[model samples]
Target: MNAKTPTSPVPPYPHPAGGWGSVKALGISLMRDGAPLATASALRKQNKPGGFACVGCAWAKPAKPHLAEFCENGAKATAWELTDKRATPEFFARHSLAELRGWSELELEGAGRLTEPLRYDADSDRYLPVSWDEAIAGIGRALAAQRAADPRATVFYASGRASLEASYMYQLLARLYGNNNLPDSSNMCHESTSVALPETIGVPVGTVRLDDFEQTDAIFFFGQNVGVSSPRMLHQLQEARQRGVPIVTFNPLKEVGLVHFANPQSPAQMLTPGETTISTQYLQVRNGGDLAALTGLCKWLIEADDIAQARGGARVLDAAFIAEHTQGFGAFAQAMRAADWSAIERGSGLPRDALERAAKTYAHATAVLGIYGMGLTQHREGVANVQMLSNLLLLRGNIGRPGAGICPVRGHSNVQGQRSVGITEKPELAPLDRLAELYAFEPPRERGRDTVATCEGVIDGSVRAFVGLGGNFLRAAPDSQRLAAAWAGLDLTVHVATRLNFTHVVPGRESYLLPCLGRIEIDQQAGGAQTVAVEDSTGCFHASDGVAEPAVPTLRSEAAIVAAIAQACLPPNPRVPWNDWVADYAKVRDAIEATWPDVFQGFNQRFRDPGGLPKPNAARERRWETDSGKAQFIVPPPTEHESDPSVLRLMTLRSDDQFNTSIYSLDDRFRNVWGTRRVLFMHPHDMRARGLAEGDMAHVTTVAHDGHRRELAGLRVVPYDLPRGSVGGYFPECNPLLPLQHHAHGSHVPAAKNIPVRVKSAVA
Candidate 1:
């Protein structure tokens, strides 16, 4: 291990996912946040039938509940949100905007929850307290002014933390204001899944449910670190391993979570010293190499099927399922057969025999689940990468069956739900027609800017006003320096959030920070205390009502904030009842039910059920919603392996202590790095090839096709188990190395992974 100047005294963690370390971490978080009693009560309600969902990951709750339903990250998220420390007017008075700007993201948020609405006072270079009504009115006026000038000048952004009702109301507000410039975190994370899944399987969501893990004969994980990102999923994986199921993983780095895990909830795991091994076989696929690897698996499956047919043996391919429910099989098969083996080996950084072994394991299994995360989607050919995985699943008739489907595990709890409730730039006609009928208002038919497009538009002076429902858009996005400048150039910016982030520190010309109730905080309104709902990765719609009181009396619920903004902006409409909707959240759910009747039918009643209703999925029912009325077998074009002996493929990742853009701590326990996020992880061979070694400071420069020379200096190179010719660094910090225009072809998602970079030794 490299010996660099330690950021903290914390040592590298040696054990797997859960165990005593998780307990210790949880205890530390609780103590630091000074909310032990509140956290305990709130955690008990997490993922419960009548309680709030965990704010951490979108992994579904089990049908059978556990006492501790929350994972380690969930505990951190809850503690972080329900912290006793407050960022009050006094705190702001103590620090200047320029001083706060110098602080790290973790430091900015760790200052604690924003107690009240604040407006940036440019004259004083400080944020001062403002009345909720005053903030709302000011934002509404600015939005109206922007609309009068040009509707496209205003952009409405949403974060995944917002509830389904809140998202519905927010989108309604944007559409009513006559702008579809709605871009959310999904554009940066899982947009590829949204684009490719619909084209391939006639649906955009995962076909499998939580229970499918019990029946799955095999599970294949692509670029997902289940242990750190979605720890609860590790329980299911542990059980699968215990049941002798083959779990194959493909990633650029050998993530600790995918290698082994110990369930903290299990008494045996707590008492036992040994941990359960996770992946039966781990393949270190190169960054942006999933497409080639998946194609290789498909090719091997085809070859095996042909050999079986010649020998008059049992068939490997599900021919019956193919003939009945799919299209373009012939073209897909031809493409797979023609895939170059050498190209697959080079692209994937794995030998042909290894891929063959993986294919054999997959072919032998009666049921298989394909799981993936941002790593597959944050690439130049992300859509193609996802389509290739779908192609592999379709070969084995994985769709419309228990334990057999494609599961794109999402990072945010309700990112999928946000899209489901109409928080989208691309509005389908069916939903628009229904919404118009329900609200008696015409929705804008034109397509709006996505995340990448919004950034470009803002930079170019097209987007002038920005309203964020949640999230640190400036930090989470690509080209941080450019984005900061663009955001500052905006005429007005409004953020409804619980805590202070980097985005709040860097204000637009005029900005307002509207403090909102956290997920674990009670939301009281005119009608009474209200409950909000969230959807998990599996499309399960469940209610999430806060158990604790709001961090501050002045804080408002997300639904209330959106409704207030909408009420203030638009003229009074007889058909739309924003006031009534804000008073009771049921009315908002009713509005959603009215719009998407097929999916949200009886939503209010069904949402209260112990296990929330599953959203309607055409792919799960084998009912294709495509033009041909069948799931399409997309034949992704073969991609040549792009390799430069002088440059390494750089992939950006989240530290174990971070969730999305929220940094809990600087320590990344799983990867053994302590107290620092500025270090790079690379294979020893690669470091040696570049005349570098462990703890050597390096300057990393991107080889972008757009000719933008993006670089990050003074990155400490730490030799690790990553594939040769590949390097890894934490995101947000590395986001600068990614060009604004370098993104997936159709999805427009920034290729945070697969950045081509050259590293040179830097004098430190």
Candidate 2:
């Protein structure tokens, strides 16, 4: 294996997920965070009904909680936030912004939590400490000035980690200021699901619960690596396997997690030195091939059902359910039957027999659940891809039934919750009338800029002020170089953050980094130690109260920060009660209930229950809220993006050691790549075809249809098990190659998963 750096020798990891390796990783995290005993105690409280939820992936908590419900990645998120180290004013005094910009992502965050609010000093190019009052006043003044000109001039960005209370406060602040410019982390990941699911199933969220895994007879995973992205999910998969459930995985790369997984918590498996096989069948589909694969499955199922009906056997198609609970089935079935097998095989890069076998499994199963991740959602046809999955489930009467539904696995802990509580660019979807009546202020009704629009706004000088609640916006977004430049051109940029990130250093004319409490930190307000609530991927609303003492005493909770800014910018409003809401988080929940009564009624009381209340989803009751009053079968045309023979389809992936833009380590332990992130994974055949071999340094250039080429140099090409004409690279580093304008059709999510690129040996 070729390593980009010489810090350590690259060796393939032959073991499965979560065994001695996970234990070792946890030990390293504890040592690095400098509080093993405290961290250990804090870990025990994670995901407990009485404690905080894991700040990692939003996998639903098990009904029967274990002593150690957290996964390896969960421990990393906790340790990263609860680190004993502090980045005080003195630390900033020694490091200039220019110097810090050159530092790695891991190095900047590892410096530790910000202990005070800091303002950018352009002359010194260093961050200087500013009082919280002054910081709020300055930001308030800037926001007010921007609103005076045009509320659309200001862009409010929220990270998925933010609690529902903070998310509501942020969105309310933006809307009250007369604009709906609320673009969140969800736009970059699962906006496709948000767009496609409602059109097909009349609801955006998954209908399945945590217990659904137990009852599911078959599980089909598409483009999702659960073992690495959501390790806790492996426990459910392992249990399902034990119950004779067949798991099928479709991904571009043969991820080890999909092949097998070993739970460290299971003493029998750990002591006996054996692992449970995860995926019964693994299909290495081509990048952006999910649509084709799903179409093939549908075609095969339709054929099998026709044969079954002709033979007077039990019908394979759910005729009764489909006839009664669905629309556009005739056209959908006709399209499926007419789908070309050669095209499906070519597009999916899988044989006809493979898809037929998968379809057979689905036809035989009583309950089938389909799970997908960013891989399916981060494409030009992302929305179509998601709808295709929904079509498959609807055909089998899988939806609105026990153990069966379409699940779009989210990366962030509360991204789903953020959307539920009104963190969106679309104003019509928000409960504006209810909010207006409660707050005595008219909310904006016009649709505002999304992530892509926000970037364009900043670049075109339309957006003058930017307020990021809790994300590395510049780095996480595509076209990093241009986005950073546009961000720097802003009049003001306010970031409510716990630690340093790439966005903090890319200062606007007047920038402020207001330190805030992390998920693991105790948020003590005037009323009491407040507990913030988050809705999981499965729509379960739960309270997460931090167990560890805050790393910095001066750090404010995200809710308080938003409220303080709102109080400073907006006029004194007796109805709003900003001060009271910040003083007690329950007041925020009360406001949410009043605004969204149907979903959040009795929120405060229901939140107190050990097991959190599940948000009411009408789809669970076999109710369709669409125009047809039934589930719609959307038959999208075939994927139109033609593959270039000379170009490899490149997809951005997260290292096992990283989450979003936060790099835990350069080493991607699962992939066996160590000490560096500037490496691209390619198939051996593809490398040979390109005259590139292992250890050869290559330059990757994006082949954009608009003729705007983007390139990344000095990337080491390493051989992997990906399909031919497909390659993979770590995100943020390869994000530069992604064009900001090149996004999904309806969702506007940057097509980060499918980039047509050509890789060649570096000239140097």
Candidate 1 structure lDDT: 0.87
The Cα RMSD of model 1 versus the native structure comes to 2.5
Q: For candidate 2, lDDT tens digit of each residue in 164-238?
A: 999999998988888999999989999998999888888888888887887899999998888778988898899
Looking at model 1, residue 538 earns an lDDT score of 92
Candidate 1 per-residue lDDT, tens place, 608-720, comes to 77667889988988898888999899989767577558978899988878888899899887888888999988877777666776778889988877755688899987877
TM-score of the candidate numbered 2? 0.98
- Candidate 1 versus the native: TM-score? 0.97
RMSD of 2: 2.4
Clashing pairs in 1: 52-544
Per-candidate RMSD, Å: 2.5, 2.4
Model 1 misplaced regions, further than 4 Å: 1-13
Q: Which run of 10 residues does model 1 get worst, by summed lDDT? A: 3-12
Residue pairs in clash, model 2: none
What lDDT score belongs to each candidate, Candidate 1 first?
Answer: 0.87, 0.88
**What are the per-model numbers of colliding residue pairs?**
1, 0
